[model samples]
Target: MRPLKSLVAASVLLSGCNGMPVAFTQDPVYDQAFVVHSGGPLPYMLMGTAVQWNEEYAVTVKHIPYVPGSVYQGQGDIQFFRHKANGVPLWRGYTPGEAVTAVGYNSLYMSVKGSGHALPAMVRLDAKEGNVLYGTHDGPVAKGMSGGPVFAADGKVVGITVAFLSSSELAALKRPDLASQSRVSIFLPYAEINREWGRYLAQAQPVTAAPTHLASR
Candidate 1:
């Protein structure tokens, strides 16, 4: 195993939000997220959630199998376009430390993983249900959720799911024992993720109708 990389590692603890941790799913933050499929034999095998950033490209963890890279190295051999969008993207922003919701797309990868930690395939965040932001939560983020998005208090975008924290990584942080804290999903801050892809979003344009030309026959 290459080891998880986003769970409970390097986070910014926020305040004011409850910290009791809710169930696997009940919130609608997953509404803002869509299932992304990788073009492969098992289209659903390499699936995760993609968050809509604007009008052009949706965002997800680049490490997800949907992201183009070497699978042997855990870089996700497939891409994020095999599946189609199911709904509209989010249209709001998020605040730090506010209890939000999350949902994971049910994928074959999860089935193969033996339901690691007994967590559901979906994600959810709530204000009074231990849905803290900036760092910390007590839910459940399974293996296939690598590219999912973390929601804010009002169903807005906050962070993009990264990966689970490995034992060595947890030990380095001196926070060994990630038993009940399996839902402490780690995500890349929205601003940083934006900065990395803002230019692409700004420049990406949709195809429009072509204009007629006098020389055309």
Candidate 2:
């Protein structure tokens, strides 16, 4: 895996403030999976990765960012792209002020801090015109949320939840004396997975026998 620094450089180049807003006419191409630790079922979603796995089990590790204080109000959604194949869900669920890390393309990862819950939320917009694709409401980010998927209404993997900011960071951003800080969450582009799906599947070992045709997609 590439180091976080190297990954950030590439991500920055690929990251954009705009998204496409055309209504989705078809269901996502991949199936959604979860890596829950001990909860009934989370507001789970699906995501995809290019890295092949030794086993079919979901990738449960996560990287969170570092932030200072209570600037986030926890009221929005984080936007990201979905890989067409080998789609894996990136999990996001943290307190208003927490620190976490996330893995990215080129095997790079980064640490991020959350200011408030709202800061971690994403708003999918039109890639061409920058219009809203869809939005998710804010809710409590629980433990073991890492490695879970953030899904769209059509059940497509949009983005993964990385982490939240620390209390000090939030306070600093909210301070009247300081300029506003832009809140961010790290995510893997879904399209990237689509490009690398074969590579990942080749490396993945089935955890269980493939489900029956009716049971399986």
Candidate 3:
């Protein structure tokens, strides 16, 4: 683990200000995933990534920071700039220190440059009972990474980015120096996500095309 940096970069949050994620691969899934937009204005700016769960709804973290009463908040919209995701639910299973990929808006307004890119990250599992399925690691998980999908070694969704360890939490673990290394943290392993969100998948309907006009015969 790396030494602690300033806490400004500490604590992973739910994801961002909003913009589309650039293409990570030619793979249809990666191509389809992009930042999703909602809400409005400076203070209300909000963004996150979502996968095409099925026809009706995409899977994303439930807690969005910019939404009112949320832990994180901001304002803007950018999903329109890129292709809306058509990704299927991710395949799951992971190990500590495993290589994983994270795709989301890293910047609040996409002003920070590299923030909107779909990048690779690693998994750092903490040895705690409650966090058994969940884990902590060097995210790179910035404000916009929430709701972004965490892909496994096989390149499938294993987790949805959720919360990260805070400076205080690190101190409690007696690893105060690791704050920097732990900065941009991640939680919400896919196993847990599937258990919770899986039920709805079956209940969902398939995406279908609109009926054609066929006006004159």
TM-scores for all candidates: the values are 0.51, 0.28, 0.53
Q: Is candidate 1 or candidate 2 better by lDDT?
A: 1
Per-residue alpha-carbon lDDT of candidate 1 for residues 98-215, written as tens digits (9 for 90 to 100): 5655545444322111111112222212223232223334444554454566665555665565544433444544453344343344555555454545434344454555666744
Which 10 successive residues of model 1 have the least lDDT summed? 111-120
Instruction: Quote the RMSD, in angstroms, for model 3.
Output: 12.4
**Residue 132 lDDT, candidate 3, scale 0-100:** 35
For model 1, the superposed segments whose C-alpha errors exceed 4 Å read 1-29, 40-45, 66-96, 108-136, 166-168, 174-183, 199-217
Q: After TM-score superposition, what is the CA distance of residue 71 in candidate 2 from its true location, in Å? A: 38
Clashes of each: 17, 60, 9
Name the lDDT value of residue 83 in candidate 1: 30
Report the Cα lDDT for residue 84, model 3: 32
lDDT of model number 1:
0.42
Order the candidates by lDDT, highest first. Answer: 3, 1, 2
| Model 3 lowest lDDT segment of ten | 72-81
Candidate number achieving the greatest TM-score relative to the actual structure: 3
Between candidates 1 and 2, the TM-score winner: 1
Q: Candidate 2 on 88-186: residue-level lDDT in tens?
A: 444233322233322221112121111122233333322332332221223222222333344433334443443322233334335332224343333
